[model samples]
Target: MASNTNLTPPRGLEGLDLLASAIIILDDDNRVVYANPAAEHLLESSVKALSQLRFTEMFLNADSLNAVFRQATENLFADWRQDLTLERSGREPLHVHCIVSALDKPGMAILIELRENVQQLKLDREERLLDQSQANKELIRNLAHEIKNPLGGIRGAAQLLELELPERHLKELREYTQVIVKEADRLQTLVDRLLAPHRRPHIVGDVNIHEVFERVRSLITAEFPSGLAIKRDYDLSIPEFRGDKEQLIQAVLNIAHNAAQALAPRIAAGDAQLIFQTRIARQVTLAKVRYRLALDLHIIDNGPGIPPEIQDRIFYPLVSGREGGSGLGLTLAQTFVQQHMGVIECASRPGCTDFRILIPLP
Candidate 1:
């Protein structure tokens, strides 16, 4: 029952939309012609809205864009590269490593490529790392000071309520207090999870990524215990990279856990398979560096899959698709990996979901 409308987009443009990179196309007059999905999201607007604005209207430093636009138009060239700062309303301006080129069959149209602001992105990453470091410390202290006492009280109340009521009524009264006790326990667990990353000391060393994958596989199997398979398609020749082994383990573990959770029903149906794929990528960009070599690790699952509603915000803190999920796992994973100058990206459809992590090789 597939619709045959030929809706599949041209491969290059489609790939651009899926990428975390921002892209914009401009005409000879420097008018906005196209803005990819990432650019639209980054700018907090749509292609339609962006199309109404000139390159100057969107980019705080329009001169560089204008200069390049003129050059491409005058020379009929196919490519240009520069780093420029882009300013959007409300948000602080962003620095972008830009690539521009005239389209083959074009009077004025030019392709615009964007990479994240290296300096700003680096500062933001470090600032968030510091913020998370401090936040976790406060989270631990506050949770210890605040959660434990109330949780004890709630559990105590449930036990006392069971003693006071008649047997039949005891179940109901205990259940009420039990709800409070359970929630408090869940909150305590969540606080611990949030504090875990910050509490650990860095265990820096050369890490074989496949070993990390094997560890994740073992851990996931121990948890799932039934009806799930961890399939590996690895290129074992990838070189060892400098990193915190335990942290990378935790990062990969978190992502695998989410995939396993998503595959729960499929596991029950005996149709679930989660795959670990590793390969070496060349000329790859992560947090904006065009590294000569990068580690490409993929975790793919065949499950019911993630809904589209919250896909864009999946890496944001405290977002989860599961009931009672603390939602801190993926957020923490992203934070941890990003600390090592890496990126984690996800793609999902009806029965398949994939999370890819790319880190520069050292």
Candidate 2:
């Protein structure tokens, strides 16, 4: 372990020392020889403090990196390597990807990149859940199909039976038929909703994202003309995207609509503002793909903001923060965006709320 501390290092080491992602370099003994600014912030300790500690104290294992970490290390070839999870705050684990490299001398250097573990776990769990939900949807669709054929026969049979029965008995039999019909209709509605995502043909073409935003703006204004303001902050330089225009409209609408709802009280106070902005981002990654041409769209609202309790499940089906909400809008929006190989992320604070959507162009 290198014990010497350089409060003011050279520019190269200084650059890595200031990264936002958690970064730490360990010697052959796994002692914290050099810890960066990001690592200090991530671990809630300064480099001076971290320099005296061992990596094993923070990471579960340092002697032999786990299979996941080993594979990641091999892939990056030490240009930058990291693949590990650390438990902090005595709470949930954090997923991190790291970049490793050999120092100019004999020791090793590692850079830790942080990612939201909850999101990763949620994605993994939801993948299995999506399969289950898909199966249930298919079953419901088939069942609805099967019931439609027999529903008419059953209703007709009840009518015929009613005619043959006493007037008093006819009423009771008719009620039974009505019950069956009503229940079937209710199931039919659910089936239609479940099948809606799959049945809608994907319309792929060059989409004018600004046009979609304009449509959303007009619709929101139509719905909430009073006490609510819609603002546009678009980057004209952004090019057309390859996507379904209607689906993108709905996807953006759902989020914008949610923002409007959250701004209800503020809208009533005549203090609500919703901003729609677009920009071109370079070296952006969406749905795990690094793309040079990326469209960045942000829906910002000045409102109370989403409650912390339900923020994590905002994209989940049937989960809503508002009463009487079907809770499928955001879920469907997420589904649509994911299909376009894009990502939708939300960040909320007391006075500001932002929903960012990133999609590839060309």
| The candidate that achieves the highest TM-score relative to the unseen native structure | 2
Estimate the lDDT of model 2.
0.72
The digit string of per-residue lDDT tens for model 1 on 200-238 reads: 777778999999999999999999888998899999889
Top candidate (lDDT):
1
For candidate 2, the 10 contiguous residues with the lowest summed lDDT are: 104-113
Q: Go through the candidates in order and give the C-alpha RMSD of each one to the true structure.
A: 9.0, 7.2
Q: Which pairs of residues collide in model 2?
A: 78-100, 80-99, 80-100, 81-98, 81-99, 81-100, 82-98, 82-99
Question: What is the C-alpha lDDT profile of model 2 across 1-362, one tens digit per residue?
Answer: 45544344334666865566666666555566666666676677777877776666765544455343444445545464445666554655666665554454344443344543554564554465456445644664686578666756765675666568777787777777677667756655655664576789998998999999999999999999999988889898777868999999999999999989989999999989999999987876554456888788899999988889988777766778888886777777877776787777788988999998878776
Cα lDDT listed for each candidate: 0.76, 0.72
Candidate 2 Cα deviation (angstroms), residue 121: 12
- Scored against the true structure, residue 132 in model 2 reaches a CA lDDT of 46
Q: Measured by TM-score, how close is model 2 to the native structure? A: 0.65
